[model samples]
Target: AQSVSQHNHHVILSEAASLELGCNYSYGGTVNLFWYVQYPGQHLQLLLKYFSGDPLVKGIKGFEAEFIKSKFSFNLRKPSVQWSDTAEYFCAVMPGYSSASKIIFGSGTRLSIRP
Candidate 1:
């Protein structure tokens, strides 16, 4: 079965610190990768995504992710962290080569940033 995995269950850091969240997927075919963020009390928003062409994609708020097809990984990274960056990060994968494929989201990684 196709699935997404986020290695970090919870991450803690101070302001200005760097952040990296590991994500991996299980599938043998083409897929669309996405990183979604849900703030403390806000709805889930797309942070970044990788479909085709360039494997590297940059999203809003200085967030970026790299799609390494060989390892089936799409890790999220940020140069600096802020208190407002505290949120739940979810790595989602849409199996198949089409845009209408079903999306499977990872359990989630809760980020805590202290000022």
Candidate 2:
């Protein structure tokens, strides 16, 4: 079975501050990685993803992630964060190429941005 781990449970930052959230998986074979963000009361939205091709993938809202195969990591990053970016970020993984595969999610990282 595959699992995702998010090291940071909560993160607080002021506007314009840089942000990075750690995410790791337990799978050793081909897998899919994704970052999803959920706002205060909104539905979960896809931030970024890495299936194949480039290891470095860019996402919406100035977000990006690097798929480090050797480290089994897909860390999310943003050069500068905004107050609107405040949300609960989740790291998810699905083993194999099947979109119907069960997607395992991390515990989630809550991000709070100061005005």
Per-candidate TM-scores read 0.95, 0.95
TM-score (C-alpha) between model 1 and the true structure: 0.95
Residue range 6-108, candidate 1, lDDT tens digits = 9899999999999999999999998989999999989999998888989989999999999999999999999999999999999999986665768999999
Q: Which ten residues in a row have the lowest lDDT in candidate 2?
A: 94-103
Residue clash pairs of candidate 2: none
Which ranges in model 1 have alpha carbons more than 4 Å from their true place?
none
Q: What does candidate 2's lDDT look like per residue over 1-115, in tens digits?
A: 6789999999999999999999999988899899999999999999988989999999998999999999999999999999999999999998985758788999999999998
Predicted structure 2, TM vs. truth: 0.95
lDDT of 2: 0.94
Deviation from native of the Cα of residue 8 in model 2, angstroms: 0.3
